[model samples]
Target: MKENEVNAKIKAAQINNALGFFILSFGIIILFAMIFTETFIEHMTDMVAGLLLMTIGGGMMWKAKINIHKLKLNKTNDNK
Candidate 1:
């Protein structure tokens, strides 16, 4: 891959990782709040929403991690 292409991929991976972290953090916060706060139990919808957020965030983070790993592998192969 060209230098510019490699740089672009690196940047993309960084962005994805950052976004994944942000989302995962929020999801964790929501999950914790749901578990600890009594108000969430009163509103079952909120609990469900929190669960959904957690699931989606986890999935996104996993996907981003996989993408980063793939990029690193490709970069190493290119170097070899």
Candidate 2:
């Protein structure tokens, strides 16, 4: 109900989304790799897209984790 709780929930949601995207992106690359073995360029593109998605998702997940940790600490302090 309070600010920290709300923020923690939001950050948790964001983390879930980032992770989901990251996993899905890899799944796409893997599927394409099998389907495009004859095309080197297509494989490269798939790898690049997968890497980009992973980088972006990782950053977002890191930010969410920091926020979640801060919220947890605040909650702990409030309880004490």
RMSD of each: 2.5, 3.8
In the predicted model 1, the residue pairs found to clash are none
Summarize candidate 1's per-residue lDDT along 20-73 as a digit string, tens digits.
Answer: 677777766776666566674555765677677777777777877787788788
Question: Candidate 2 on 1-80: residue-level lDDT in tens?
Answer: 58766776876767676785676567566656656566888777677776666676666667776766766787678778
lDDT (CA) per prediction: 0.73, 0.68
For candidate 2, the per-residue lDDT at 18 reads: 71
Candidate 2 has an lDDT of 0.68
Off by over 4 Å in 1: 35-42
Clashes per prediction? 0, 0
| Highest lDDT scorer | 1
